[model samples]
Target: MNELGLNFLDLGDSDKLPIILIHGMALDQTMWTPQIPVLKEHYRVLTYDIRGHGLSEVGDAQYTYKMFADDLKSLMDYLEMDQAVLCGLSMGRAIVLRAYDMYPHRIKAMILSDARSEADSNETKYWRENSIESIKKDGLENFADELVGNIFCQFQFQEASGSGGVNSKHRLIIFIRGISQPLSSSQMMHDKIVNSEFKIIPKAGHMSNLENLEEFNHNLLEFLGKIEF
Candidate 1:
């Protein structure tokens, strides 16, 4: 673990460009198992658990986007990396965005899976509050079942604004079922960012990487090939 109490695996050659993979909420770095072996061959791969998850220490401070972004920056500084490619999933996507906002120059590029870039609406906030209440009222098992039920349902398509901005021109947006976020967000991001590519892994849900590892990795590698540093 680094100075920030982040449990991480630094793989691949030290001289190579870095790729940081951030997992979704409630998930640890192991979620990126499928991509590591392949990615490590070409780039320096860094996979770590966010604070309060996996082996990482849970500090007393309330967890927020800024806190997570700061931790990411600290890790990069500790690794002596001036910049790196940030790839994230689900809540991890939000962290990647926040990190870029905080330290744009440190981000060489981004690969976002199941991406979303908008403030939570009242309905979304209520759903999250209810989820917390459900975990407290019911149990982790029940909550897991309910969450699975929600994730595996038919994909619901929604529209979102492309108002979010990023400093980097190179980005790869990947998604499965357009649930939990609007499909237009990807389109807007692709439209806004130069050298950006948008891709979809068919016959998959939110966990598209796990559901269709081949296609996901293909899109990821193809995107990486286009990047210069």
Candidate 2:
């Protein structure tokens, strides 16, 4: 735990350049276990459970990306880190964007996988609301079909009240997303955040990281291997 009391797994040599990995919504650090072996050898990799998920304590108030980003900033400050490679997947991507928005200089690079630059889509919002209503009316077991299909980790980049949003593309960005999923919004995201190598993992869906760990790890290492420390 650092400043926010977020349960975290901090590994590798302290002197190494830091690489912070943020997991998707409803996911814990364990989702990143597969990538740790390689990352530990070259970088100080940090993985932490976000609030209300995994082993982290749940906050009393409503959750927001700003709050999540602040927690991350606090942890980094406590660790005395000036900059780090920030990697976020799905919902984690939104948190990453929030942190970058608040402290751009703190982020050295980014690894965004299967994420959008906006909030839940209409279809997603409908199903999400239905799930909530079903749970409230029938309890956890009422709907036993076990919601099929992939629940993607997504995001939307918001801006200040009068400010235009993040328009320019980011440098050192690596975008990896699954090809099986609907990617209508991907072009929009890429257009705004220009060229960063985009790799589509074959035979994978929204949960590309877990679906094809071997391929994901390979691509990730290739990217990290080339980056200047």
Q: Best candidate per lDDT, number?
A: 1
> Each prediction's TM-score against the native?
0.85, 0.82
Pairs clashing within candidate 1: none
Compared with the true structure, what per-residue lDDT tens digits does model 2 show for residues 90-137? 788888778878888888877778877666779977976787678678
- Give lDDT per model, in order: 0.78, 0.75
TM-score attained by model 1: 0.85
92-209: candidate 1 lDDT, tens digit per residue: 8888888877887788888788876567679977987787688789976888877765664253222102226664444444333333335776676666766566787765567777
209: Cα error in model 2, Å: 1.4
Task: Quote the lDDT for 120 in model 2.
Answer: 72
Evaluate residue 222 in candidate 1 and report its C-alpha lDDT on the 0 to 100 scale.
86
